[model samples]
Target: MLKPISTPTRELVNLDGVWRFAIDSRAGAEPWTGLLGTPLEAAVPASYNDLFVDPEIRDHVGWVYYQREVRVPRGWGGERVLLRFDAATHAAKVYVDDELAGEHVGGYLPFDVDITDRVAAGERFRLTVAVSGDLSNETIPPGKIEVGMNGKKKQTYFHDFYNYAGLARSVWLHSEPKTRIADVTVVTGFEGATGSVDWTVVTDGVDEARVRVSLSDAAGAPVATGQGASGSLTVPDVTLWQPGAAYLYELTVELLDEGDSVIDSYPVAVGVRTVEVRGHEFLINGEPFYFTGFGKHEDTAVRGKGHDDAYLVHDFQLMEWSGANSFRTSHYPYAEEVLDFADRHGIVVVDETAAVGLNMGVVGGMTGTPPFPTFSEQYAGAATQAAHAEHLRALITRDKNHASVVMWCIANEPASNEEGALEYFTPLVELARELDPTRPLTYAMVMFATFKNDRIIELFDVVSLNRYYGWYIATGDLATAETYLHGDIQGWIDRTGKPIMMTEYGADTQPGVHSVWDQAWTEEYQVDYLAMNHRVFDRFPQFIGEQVWNFADFATSNGIHRVEGNKKGVFTRDRKPKAAAWALRARWRGLEGRKPGSDGSTGAGSGEVTGADGADG
Candidate 1:
């Protein structure tokens, strides 16, 4: 016999308005000390840059201190108070009433601290958070070494991206009952289309509980139901979800005590989609669809990565208008709002983990000391590898319900020559399969180093090649580049039956700049580059898709090719559209009614033809 589940009423306190802010140099500085008597001002979502008018002060790097006072509800005395941060860069030390509370390391992931113990009922509690902006080395995965900007004789390599260090995402206070659901795990299968949900319910009393699970469709119609013990429930005949026609199913789990009185209930939304790679073609619901898109960075000109909801909505609209049906959350996992937008907009997402820059190498130079010994150990130790596998499992478990996510990218541009990479990636691939067998696992392979290991390629369901041919290799030779790209992909297809996706390809363009010399900075050059790739894309049916190098021009600390960052966006950093925007729109809008593989198929009226043409520098 099972117990009925009860749902708790959740109240969200909007901590968005302004609070008091100050900059401190000391490591353990506590803002709560004088906060109670000091005057309070607007501080919500404000950046350190907002305070300084001087250029030097604006760019100064150190610790920024933020403080706020919130009154706990009189009736919410027994309830648990959770302080949640959507994101905090680098490192953060949280304090309540001058008492040290908790600390967090990673900048991108969401974390919360139980601050109930530190807060008094019906009284205003002072909360202070000190965040360090010291990015001397990449603390996260995919760490890099670079030449230090301070003009030190020694060269340093670091991760690329603007260090918009602060509370770049959001902060909130949530209150929940003592007896509630701690976490839930939902897994789907294709065999008879069954779904299972494991619930970890927390309670105070030793009363036996019953759980009732029900499934609903997008229209809120009941499709399946089941009853089970307090721990878990399995529902069968689940509706299979697919991209483009993403049909989401809602699961409601209710808890009841021994008296059969409902105590708490919780609901989670999930999509049942099966993804598989079969020899150079990706199958979604047993059909084929081309994945044309770009790599995304969570950066803007003014806001850096601290963008709001409107920014995300505009970015997605640009992708959809540009004929991009897919996007890679490049180098790291994006904020939850970004993923949520991707879900509703019907965009295919390759949810990449924050595991890039782990192995930074110099051309013709010997292997140097790696950044962050933690990552190095994780790459080398079996136990650490197992821990990384669990980290990936948590990521998958948290995001598996999203229909937009079709693939899980384990690592980005890891060292192909290093033996540790092979050892580390093999287990990750297996772990991804073990956790969620519904989706395929993939890693971005450097084009020049693909031949080093045939065994590594075997583990991936789809073979993704990141080629910067015309952009980096033969910058002036388009024809030779296309020929090489075509031949290389063909050879790989012959070797591995796994589907192929040109994971990355694009040229940098200075938005709004028009050049007659080579059109490199002009929108014409951007369109020409895509037109050339489309020619090759039309010839290769085995290639599943091509994601452009980037979706927007992002801030990079490391400048390459005399550019501060990769200026490869079809739009500027400020979300302004380039001339190439409409050109891409014309191409993706049903190929402009031109037959596939037909010469002069480009609808831009630029007289560009579909063929391999050589150009002299």
Candidate 2:
């Protein structure tokens, strides 16, 4: 008889306390091994700035070593022990008991290393991890600065966010049975307005496992159930989930043996909706709904990249209040909690990969002396392209089952004209279709819309353009901006006859300031900009939806336009709503005949219609 699958309780071993930290300044130094009496005390999951205020500490860029001692539980014997890092910037090399455990790259995603073989049960062991953020490492993605040397063509990124390098997220010790469920992928489909759930389970075990998958409504009542072998199962007659009528169904999958003893269980909230690009217009369940949202960066002023559920929820409320129905995870994949909230709140998402091809010069046509040697073997060559492709693949595969995700964007502002860029992009688009055919494929095109490269647009199910109408080109020239935007988009529609979305459009507004030198900082200007866009939006039959340039104020190291940062969000950096919020809410609510306080009070639940947790007033 098999054990019934049970939900694994996450017991967090807080590694946030003080840990021994030191900077390794020597070039190519072996992993620090010398034992010292007492080291500089620094908190785990804290930045170097949190402990010291030296300008050198702030500007210093290199490897930082952290050491700590932990005792393995005696009861944890025979179980597979895993060390999970919520996040570590750049590169992390982990060692246990002087044995090299593993290394991981990429700062946003979660990674774990199995330490069962490296450490004995009930034994005290010293764990050392060295983290490096050397800007010269080609494997590490460029951030904040650009380096040009000897025509070896390596371009650093000039982004608008702080480079908080550390264990910026969480770390934990997870224990699981040697043979357990590995992963789960759940997908939902809506046919004729009815929904169905399909799930695939990956496991490692010799015994034949019984799998039970259950779908529940928001109130936690079982709506559908399916049972099968430890592989795949399909549940029919699921509740159709919509954007405003976001009726989410929680999915629980359990691995069990013939005896009904539980083994392991995993749960994820899922919504059921159909998204398609139909002849120039994107449709959601055959309804024409406009997208009004912003791009979001997963960073905070104080928290850095630490996962904060409350902050995420507050962001959702602010967006909904500002009349947004959709958003994009700009430049990278965001936290799972953000996506989960989107699923429940009915916010459409353009789940983008961590591939921001900002280095691609074709978008802005910024041509200069090439940075790298043209024909050199290491000329930002195929290996870099391949690494990027692999990263994109991992991102897509990791988040494929998310129902809120309406499109897969392979690269953001990539160098389209580069020799092998299209070569990399085309295969990724094909791979996205192969993995999940339900959603469309999209890439953000900037500036040039000539048909000379329409072939790239033809490969995608939907073609999107990120136009900076009045901001970058002409300020206060609303009529000209509209004419240009409408003409370019209509031309694309006439050429491809494919569905189109205005993936990005908005002006930067400095919150709390009403500037007479052009209302760039005033809420009035923000409202007028969106209102004018709505006029053009009403005329464009081919356009599906429009997501604004940003949702909230995010950290940007590169402060441009004398504005200190990208002050484009409808809300301030602290998630405070600007005066434009009310105007957007009125438009989104479509509340032509309704009066304020008609539903009773004026608080979270006082409005006639609630906006994602009844928080819009």
Candidate 3:
């Protein structure tokens, strides 16, 4: 399942415009035989939930059908044509010319079906896709869809985000040779002044084939070359991809015929570096790299969870402006373009899964409160674990080669203290390690999990904690919150001798509300909360990274707890800088020119932030 890298010989057609859309609310809709001509039109790579004004259409909790007509290029005959959908939420089924093509479970990953035979036989093809955003006890981000007192279905989950559904990414038709290179796995390291690249090329149609791997510098100069399906190459003078001074090498894999003529080639972008955890230190290229960034979500106005190029470029620029060197794909993996940008700009990413809000009934069992039914021990059985394992394989197979993805975060705030949590995560952790041992594995531990109850912490290479000492637990008391935060973090350090990363720590702040002093939901309060966390973070040498809860305000499900979505973002929803944004900019800027392995005594101080310029203030 190696991701396809575009080459000059490859043919690609993007299907990314308006398409006929309709909702199958009756749940009687079947692919390849049902309704044909729908009048309503929606963007192909957009969310159907947010496009409509009607409440029923906005909150429709059933199958969404998208139909379009595509003409396969006449030259694509004899070649393997792939009908690729970049992403479809929760579940998706594809049909071509009223024939079942493929069905895929789980979303946020790419899936494709071979249509070479059919495409060669037809001039025009009818393409249809049915997508479901439904979640249950059996799903990864487990939840329940129950009828409320008002006779309307309500979607309730442990996560604090909206369930946006549709073809959230791209759709395309790509042509490849019948016998081609299927995958390329790369592991890079340094040997003295030179760099080493060890790789394995997996091919289909033949057990053995002639493969040639060539390496080039950014300026298109040949550095090193090799000839084999699996071998190693040494570059004399390699440029290491460093923070602020990012560099990249171009890797080209060519598939040859028996006569040594090239049949197909894959152009890949790779960085020469290594990531490892040494004792309590997280190192990148043998340097103690401190991460200063946010736990970001792929969300914005109107688009909801849809991928947009404008927002994508804007976010990377803002991250650079804020002096951030890294960020985690908080709850799930983002679109492929986002990671490409991170690689180009030298931003480290802790790539995470969509496995958020997986807490079960165990937490409340100790107390008197009723536990969550969807995440109980009944749901964490063999079936659920198998589904999760498949998702991990798809994700790792898709993103294992990216230079920006420094670590792999298997889950976010899962119920590590639950009854079956250990049993469930044990195989998953082992599976991820078996898949890619080059990267470190971690899961964001919830505050509810203490030293005595939690067992999953010992399994991970790094310890990632999402603690809210002053916000959720201590209300608004930073004085008392400091003591609680210090003790909890120290206890974890004593328990596991691994590097600690604060994956989430922030206070929600409304846009306009201001207070001279610290008041809840005020701009000053967020600034104060961040300052306290920074002060405490400076005390520990084992603390390697500090990623805030959110990078910007995002849309979420309507609930009493959320005020116009999560306001924990340093920037507003429209990408405007709040007071806390300026505070962070100043703090991160001070650490800009410093070397990687430095002990910081430079604490952040108060600063005056300005108003929004071009956008509405």
Give the candidate number with the greatest lDDT: 3
lDDT (Cα, tens digit) per residue for candidate 2, span 142-176? 44334347432222443445556677666667677
Model 1 local distance difference test score = 0.63
Question: What RMSD does model 3 have?
Answer: 5.3
In the predicted model 3, the residue pairs found to clash are none
Looking at model 2, residue 249 earns an lDDT score of 72
Please tell me which model should have the higher lDDT, number 1 or number 3. Answer: 3
What's the TM-score of each model vs. the native?
0.83, 0.83, 0.93
The number of residue pairs in model 1 that clash at the backbone is 35
Candidate 3, position 169, lDDT: 92
Cα lDDT tens digits for candidate 3, 13-120? 899998878788642446457555466778978888888887887887778888888888888777889888888988998888778888988888899888776666
Residue 128 displacement in candidate 1 (angstroms): 1.2
Give the range where candidate 1 is weakest over 10 consecutive residues by summed lDDT. 608-617
Which candidate, 2 or 3, has the higher lDDT? Answer: 3
TM-score of candidate 1 versus the correct structure, residues matched by position: 0.83
| Higher-scoring candidate on TM-score, 1 or 3 | 3
